[model samples]
Target: MNAKTTKTAENVTRCLKCRRVLRNASPDGYGPKCRKKVRAAARAEVVAQYKPHQVAKAQELLEQGGLIPLRANRVFLAVSSDGSATYKTHRAACTCPAGIKGLHPCKHRIAAHILLAA
Candidate 1:
């Protein structure tokens, strides 16, 4: 027979709005529903902080990766199957058809930008 370690229900989990319990919690000890809301809020905060700077830096270095600039501020890099292009301030779009369909910039762009930043 296994002996129960003697722990109260409050020590493990807390009641959620819909009665579904959560196994994890916020660092300060939030109940399941509250923990979920807190996690979402934290993720949003992180995205807001890093997205803009990351896009701008990536755009500025597009040329170093053998890309051609389509505009004053845009840069394009070629891939084996397609091409990639981005703007100095926004990397969300590129000239490659794959870009039109929504794909990530490639290693060359990344390396060029990294060198430029250095």
Candidate 2:
């Protein structure tokens, strides 16, 4: 290929997450560091928006597969801490007791936010 064609092909093979040119690109399109950094950044942004306990619970909820999207992804079903109940959650509202009070975003809401943000 000519020099122009070679340079254009290089740009097309950049890291998916950071847009940096990759010398040895992976099939998934992300460099190792960029992959980790992208995930960490998404998680960090969610954690930074809430209290520690809430973030922890949100992480638990996500890891446990407790959050299920519904209504074309506009709402979610968040399983309670004890797994005995589920709260209907939206981006700004949740049916959980803490959410009903409206004092702050509850764990369920935080979990939903994390899902949507990611």
Candidate 3:
């Protein structure tokens, strides 16, 4: 019932899930495959926490150029199709209704992520 251990100059660790010796010192002691599974689980957890409409709205915003960055990435303004400004942000959401309401990531966040990726 005891996990295997590996010793190196840096540290000694064992895989918490599989009880295998870990070559590197991961906080969770997960091997490569287990780390992938952990990441996937975390992603799934985040996806499950969002409402369906939020995801759809983010996708629509990305596709329709609804997000406009003003002043050299210092701020973003997200305009809806109806021509109403729904969100604004510099480093974080400033005046988004969804953000204000504490809902999941609004379109502004998604747009900012896309812009940063570019």
Candidate 4:
């Protein structure tokens, strides 16, 4: 079959990057290898924009489903596994110690960003 032609089984398409026959449908036309590269690039971008600690905290919150919405708009509470709540304001900043010190964006802020992006 020609390179441009789809596979017979369910008319499966090819990967855009490697031009290999795709076994499954991918919205971006990327097969497993290319998809992994794309995901890794996206993750690297996020890591570059945030501190390591903030990223770790955001990941933890996501894993634990710890982000909670508060009464106010653009406001949220990031609850830790230990049941501690850290206030985060999208427009302003978080109330965590790191946020209060203004040294860096806190984990609560990172978690809020991650949750909102999701």
- How many residue pairs clash (N, CA or C atoms closer than 3 angstroms) in each of the candidate models, in the order given? 3, 0, 0, 0
TM for candidate 3 is 0.46
What tens-digit string does per-residue lDDT give for candidate 4 at 1-118? 6868765556758764445888787664557775565345436665578877768866666445455556432567666457855455452587766678978777777655654443
**lDDT, model 3, position 104:** 60
Ordered list by TM-score, greatest first? 2, 4, 3, 1
The lDDT for every candidate, in the order shown, is 0.38, 0.71, 0.56, 0.60
Off by over 4 Å in 4: 1-44, 71-73
Q: Residue by residue across 1-118, what tens digits does model 2's lDDT show? A: 7875574433456653345778885654556775565356447756687888778877666656676667655688888889899999986999999999999899888766765665
lDDT of 4: 0.60
Candidate 1, residue 36: lDDT: 58
Query: For model 2, what is the C-alpha lDDT against the true structure?
Result: 0.71
User: What would the per-residue lDDT of candidate 3 be over residues 1-118, giving only the tens digit for each residue?
Assistant: 3345754475567653344678776643456765565345434534355566755665466445565556665576777657755567543564777667755666666545544433
The Cα RMSD of model 3 versus the native structure comes to 14.8
TM-score of each: 0.24, 0.62, 0.46, 0.51
| Poorly placed runs, candidate 3 (over 4 Å) | 1-53
Can you give the lDDT of residue 96 in candidate 3? 70
Model 2 TM-score is: 0.62
* Model 2: CA > 4 A from native: 1-42
